[model samples]
Target chain A: MAKVYDAIVVGSGMTGGWAAKELTEHGLDTLVLEAGRPITPAVDYVEHVPVWEKRFRGLRDRNAQLANQPIQRECYACDEWSSKFFVDDHENPYTTEPDAPFLWLRGRQVGGRSIMWGRQVYRWSDLDFEANLRDGIAVDWPIRYADLAPWYDHVEEFVGISGEPLGLPQLPDGKFLPPMELNCVERVVREALAKRFGRERVLTIGRVAILTQNHLGRAACHYCGNCERGCVTLSYFNSINSTLPAAQRTGKLTLRPYSVARSLMYDKKRTRVTGVRVVDAQTKHDIEFHGRIIFLCASTLESARLLLLSATPELPNGLANSSGQVGRNLMDHVMGGGARGRIDGNLDKTDTGRRPNGIYVPRFRNLRDGPKSPFLRGYGYQGGGDREHWGRGVDQAGFGADFKRAMRDPGPWHFSLYGFGECLPNHDNYAELDKTKTDAYGIPVLKINCRFGENERAILKDASIAAAEMLAAAGAHDINPFVENNPPGKTIHEMGTARMGRDPKTSVLNGWNQAWDIPNLFITDGACMASSACQNPSITYMALTARAADHAVELLKRREL
Target chain B: MDRRDALRLFSATAALPAVPDLLVLGRRLHERLTARPALRTLDPHQNATVTAVADRILPATDTPGATAARVNEFIDLLLTEWTPQEARARFLAGLADLDARARAAFGKAFVDGGEADQVRLLIVLEDEALRLKEQPGPHPEPFFRTIKYLTMYGYYTSEIGAKQELHFEIIPGRYVPCTPLSAASGPPGGD
Candidate 1:
């Protein structure tokens, strides 16, 4: 008989890393399985190389783009430097309806999407927590702000979030390091917005996961501006750099790579989950590992799809999916609404080194003691200041000796504001197992069917107008507000497929992130989010996973499992 | 054979070889074909025709002319390598259409026409391309966009085109968000 472990965790992303760290530290024999390829830090990241030293002038070929990433092109970060982190669409294909195009941007490696994440960390306030209850949406989240506050502090201290304490109700404050400085154009825009719309509509620097000062054995950011290419110095807080290494130090972790988890092994006699059945990716041999508890952190849709595929007589629909809400309530942040314009008067002053962080205008419209708007929720603005580079000069057209002299100087300052709007929880937006289509691994792929609703459209329109007004107030010239035609999942903030709630009828997991039906199972990835918050959910997911892992350890000690 | 001879023969036969001789040959061929004096050295009629058409599309401004930017050479390189077979064929067809349009409108080949006549012919071609971009077709818009993109790309990336048309700073050591317009007009600070 194979030896049984105390706990098993799927995936090695944001939540999985936290879960592994907490479980291992608590002395539990934790088996962390990652379906993707292994990652070697520092050696794999080639972002530190200077532009002058690069071959091909830092541009990838047409074949590389077409072969490696088709869906990833929807994102600006899927360039030559970071394309390796993203999955090749041809090998891992999924189906969607003809009209409903879902750009499922995914990275299948040890750290998963955390390797290429934008790293903008923010805390979700009561506004997001209470939105579902007020609107009578899918289901009210069982826990409140007070319940998760301590866990948030615990996670933030470990992650090293660099931010300012704004004391805004919509965007809550967290344990933060010193905030990054805003550039001149950003400062101008901030002042103009504050004067025009009052203190509530203030612009602050974004809270990034990068370390401001050296901490946790990682070096401070050198401001290389090649973050998407993976940070070699471990400045940015990716799971591989921070959490997973911490977990490994505990000696309780059994990290197995290329172990594709196929299904959960259910024992009818025990009336509980026995273990997980996995296929060895290279050998193509079926293997089973027993665990007292299981944690599914295999992303939002992937986790839900696994549950749906795990068919049994007692739980035929899916494991612990008695509520029929396993793959329902798919939500993503609605993005791509904002304005761009050239700044007037200030052209002489140019400063350097590509700044990784951008200016953040916190959510203000729907917060406490703020003005009412047509939209239910609110959106935040992320803007930055820059001058024309060599690429832009090429676009405008100039050549010869005179042009060469001119190209040496930077152009007029330009600024752009992009809005990240809050997407509400809708039951209709969902994913289901596509039995007709299969991936390269011969696993059934998820068929995503989701669309932006009326509330999202209203918020997007208002966001565009707000951005234009802010630019105008700052005395910008030739302002152009663009509304991009993008469908759901374009933001790559996919969440809320297996939500945690008070009642079992509407939600798959409980407040503690434990499955309502399966006592030994827990899910703490984006799937466990009750509602999609406007803020980046990675930090919150980390907090929730740590909390869940601690609880799971306590339950095990008490012989609850 | 000796090791040096064997290595030389091996490098000579390989496509896109890293050998010094191959690299030098490729660079010389590119420069010779694109040089301004070499362009003038062509058959007078052929030279006049190509120069007239190129100048009409991109006139000599405060900076260098399109002919000085070596746009024709860039186009030739793209036609040979970067572009697909279908796209290359379409671009060649578009060039033929330009000559035909010039003859029909002014009763003279584009090469034989004066500067003003060539400019007028380009204006007609521009309108046609714009119409093609708007039309709901799979092929037309891509073809037009490709030509426009290449034209702009070749011109602006060139040293004179980049600096004279739009200011470009390769390494602006710092990021000063706001400064007076006059200070920005000169060479970057520290340079």
Candidate 2:
């Protein structure tokens, strides 16, 4: 007889780790299927590795990146040391239109992308949840801020977010530790913005998933300045740093690395997903794992691809895709429109240590009480002020002793404000199976077709003008306001496709993130997102995963699953 | 946490508080240096010319210079392995051109020329680089600017340059938002 686990969680990443921890802690024997190699922190963590140790110094291996990770190299985190965390583009192939180039940045490992995540955690408000219904853009979200508030509190408590309380309704305050401080120039800009824009444009320290003080037995951040390279102190909230360990503490987690899930096993008679068929990455062999309930926590596009791959004759579109929304309405944050300027006067002042977090300007546009804009949604700015360092020597033409001495001292303080605008859920912007090409594992790849709409561009244009206006108000010089034409999926906050909604006829999943068609199947990752909010999506994904796991456990106890 | 529990959690714990042992870091850097073979590509004359150009660009001041940081060695490594064939060929040709110009000016190779002569020749190259910057087409980067770029890149990223010159700390323990310029210890590469 095959060993049937109580629950099976796919993709041991941000959401998968949370689901595993929540389910296993409730005394369920959960098996975590990770498609990538297991990480040994001591061996793999490269945050402490000095730039001199790398062969390319911080330049990155150009030849290797061009050959293996042409698409992965598009990411800022895919540097010399941390590039190992990202997937090789050849092995994990996905296609996009020549005109519509989608950069599918992925990290397939035990901890997944959580290892190289940006760590900026922000909670979404009712403003975000009810945006679709208010605008009549797409189907309304089944859940709201009220429903997910407790879950946000639940995850934020364990994750150890450090942020200031702004008391803003649009971007609600979370359970925070000590907020990281704003630097001298940042403070100058913050005060200037406060005086000019009042409470509408609040510039606060970034609410990050990094420990300011030790909590839950994990150590506080050592201020290494290299969170993306993997934090050794467990100060940052990567899955391996936090949730997976908590799951392991319960002694009910069975983590299986290098198990690429091929598809879900659908039982037409039972009308439930019985198990998952996986391909062993190392041996190139087929294997099956049975579970009472399944959590499809493989990211947004991958989760949608999984459903498409599991299409049956009974339901030809896809598994649990009765609404035909499994692989539709894809969206990603349209970023790269803002300004940079020279914030003069702070010459005597400088900052010590490398603070991992930056200053965040909360979204102020298109609020309920605020003045209306031409665009439908809003955008937020994430940037900071820093004095120039030795890297500035590249442009300075002077050579010799004086130049060398000058390079040692910090240069003029420069401030930048980069915006991330909300991308509307467009049905045409979606992913489907590309039968012509298969990955190294021989599984079908995704053919994504996504592009930002007029509203997204308008929001970005407004963001640049507004950023420059703020900089001018701050008495800045060399105010260069510009809009960057970044392609879709560049921000890596890709969401939607298998979205949650009120009706099963419109959405794949319900309010609880459970598949409406399959009772035991749940998709709690970014695929469950109905709308693309300007804020970072990981924290919401974590909250939804925990809430869904709780509901799943309840169903199991009642023998209803 | 008790000793038994701490021992069990050692693997689960991301890392034992990131107080970097400079001794271990130094030893590993030393081992890496000791294991390196000779320069694979650059001949003696070309190597000497590169060393001379790098030194003039960032000569030995109160602190060490490009030579001390082994900018020549870094250039050799890049040319041999990292740089594309076309770029590598252009770089070698540029080095040869520098020698020819040196001979034309002072009847000697760039390595054999005095500091004043080398400076005069470099001034001409800088002017060319500046001119190239103004008129942008598909022209390959001016050779002198490339050398300068490599010299700066190689020097700043070196252990001596980054640690001794810039004071880059592996673990800066706590973040201090505002401090006097004189009080600031590490190089300014913060968020």
Candidate 3:
């Protein structure tokens, strides 16, 4: 008989790292199975590498990306020094409709996409949790803001977010360190918005996971600007930089890299997950690891894929998916709608370091007390002010010794406001297992069928108009308002595959993120998200994982399994 | 511990020392001592023409310019590896046409012309590039614009251009959101 651990988490990314840390600190023997190679910051980090050393001088290797990473190249983070963090398109194949193209950007390493995740953290309030119920669009969320408030506090205290307290109800405030300051043009725009729109429209520095000062033995940021390439100071909150180290400090944790989970082993009589069936990524051999309880933190689509692959005779649709909702109601943030303008007065001033964070405009549309909007939910803007650099010489006409000298100085400051709007849950937009096509490991791949609807487009249009109005009010010149029709999953906030709800017939997971049908199984990743808020979802996933780990430990102590 | 103590500990460990790898350094030194990287695409005359044209486009001022940055070698590398075969052929044809025009005007090759004559020729090319831009039909990028853009890209990304001209620091230890232009050092690299 194989020795069984107290718990097993089937990922080492954002939520997986939180689960590992929480479980092991609770004195449970936790096993973390990572699907990719281990990451060593000293060896893998390229944040400090100079452009003179690179072959292409920061213009990415286009031929290599066109050949190997056709889909992964869509992400801005998949550049010259950091493209190695992304997955090869040939090995991890997925299908989409011919018309509805989807870009499934993935990173198959120990830290997963957390290594390149945009570190914007915003707390979702009752506006998001209660949207589905108020609009009667889909199933209602089982829990509300009050239920997750303490969990948010729990994770934010450990995560060390740096942000200002705006006291807005739609976007709640979290435990924060000293906030980053706004730049010259951003301060001008903020003052203008305050003067024109009053209390409704406000601009604040982005709440990021980067450190302004040292916390929990990790060094503060050196402001090198490229967090996607890997931070050498462990300043930003990548799992390899922060959470996995904390999990390793507890001796109860065992992390295994290159262990791709295939499915969960279900015991029919006991109605509990017995173990996980995994494929050894190096040797292509099947292996098993038994645990008393299992946590599926293998991202949104991957967790849903695992559940759908584990269909047994009793649960023919999928394990713990008696509700027929394992792979339905998929959603991602609808983004790429806003405006930009040139702010001309700040030529005498400039910023020194490349601060990785930007300014944020919280949601102002369709507040409870505010005027009604044409859309159901609202959107937020994330952008910043920057003086034009030497690259502006490409368009500037004159070229000589004088032109070269002119290019050395910073040009006029320009401010932009890019919006990320909320995406509604549609039952037609979902993923199912494409049995005809398989990945390199012979596991079935997901065939995603998702697109934006009318409301999402309306929200984006409103966002562009509102952004232009604000910039015009700020006395900006040459204001350009634009709306781009971005497809689903481009924002990489894909969730709502296996959502949480009060009714077991409608949702796969309960309020505690435990599967309603399977007592010993839980999913605390983005898969348990009942709705897709406009904010970045990684912090919420972290908070939910910690809360679910605490609940799992309590159930174990009670001998429930 | 106090903030100063924390800063000291962090700078000691996390401000990773820029220690060069001995094996890589040894290999690079050996290569440098033995031979220069052979030109893969441009011939002797073509390389001379590119060097002259790029120098005229961005001449040496108080700071080092395109020639000092080895921008011709960079363009040669891109032509060899990065550009497609059709684009490479088009660029070579454009180079031949440029020599023809130079000979037609100054009765000599472009590289052998005087600095003032070279500037006049570049001004003509810039006017043609602009004329082509105002047209409506889909046309290939003018060769002057391509070489000019490449020269700017290569020079600014070079070590002398980045460190000496732009004063790009690899590690800015602190962030000052709003500082005077005189107080700020320079822009950071790879922004």
Candidates' TM-scores? 0.82, 0.94, 0.94
The sequence of per-residue lDDT tens digits that candidate 3 reaches over residues A1-561 is 898999999999999999999999999899999999999889999999988788888878878999999999889999988999999999999999999998898999999999999999999999989989988978899899998999999999888899999999999999999999898889999999999999899999999999989988878888888999999888889788878888899999899998989999999989999999999999999999999999999999999999999998878888988898898888899998999999888788999888999999999998878899978889999998889888877666778888888987888888899999899888898889999999999999999999899989999999999999999999999999999977788899999899999999999999999999998999998889888988999999998898899999999999986
What lDDT tens digits, residue by residue, belong to model 1 across residues B1-191? 35675556556557554555766766765564544533322344544554555554455766666677766655565565446677777766766666777789888777777767866665555566566656685655433334555555566556656446544444333444345545553232211
Candidate ranking (lDDT, best to worst): 2, 3, 1
Report, for candidate 3, the interface RMSD: 1.5
Root mean square deviation (Cα) for candidate 2? 8.0
Which residues of candidate 3, in runs, are more than 4 Å off?
B1-35, B188-190
Per-residue C-alpha lDDT of model 2 across residues A245-289, encoded as one tens digit per residue: 999999999999999999999899889999999999999999999
**Per-residue alpha-carbon lDDT of candidate 3 for residues B1-191, written as tens digits (9 for 90 to 100):** 45675556446544556784656655754554544478999999999999998888778899888998899888998898788888899888888888998998898889888888888888898888988988999999899888899898899888988888888888898899898887878963244
Off by over 4 Å in 1: A49-59, A390-398, B1-86, B90-191
Per-residue lDDT of candidate 2, residues B104-161 (tens digit): 9999999999999999999889888887778957788889988999998899889988
Give the number of the best model, judged by lDDT: 2
Q: Give TM-score, chain B, model 1.
A: 0.64
RMSD of each: 6.5, 8.0, 7.6
Candidate 2 Cα errors over 4 Å, as ranges: B1-36, B136-139
Provide per-model DockQ scores: 0.17, 0.48, 0.47
User: Which CAPRI tier for candidate 3?
Assistant: acceptable
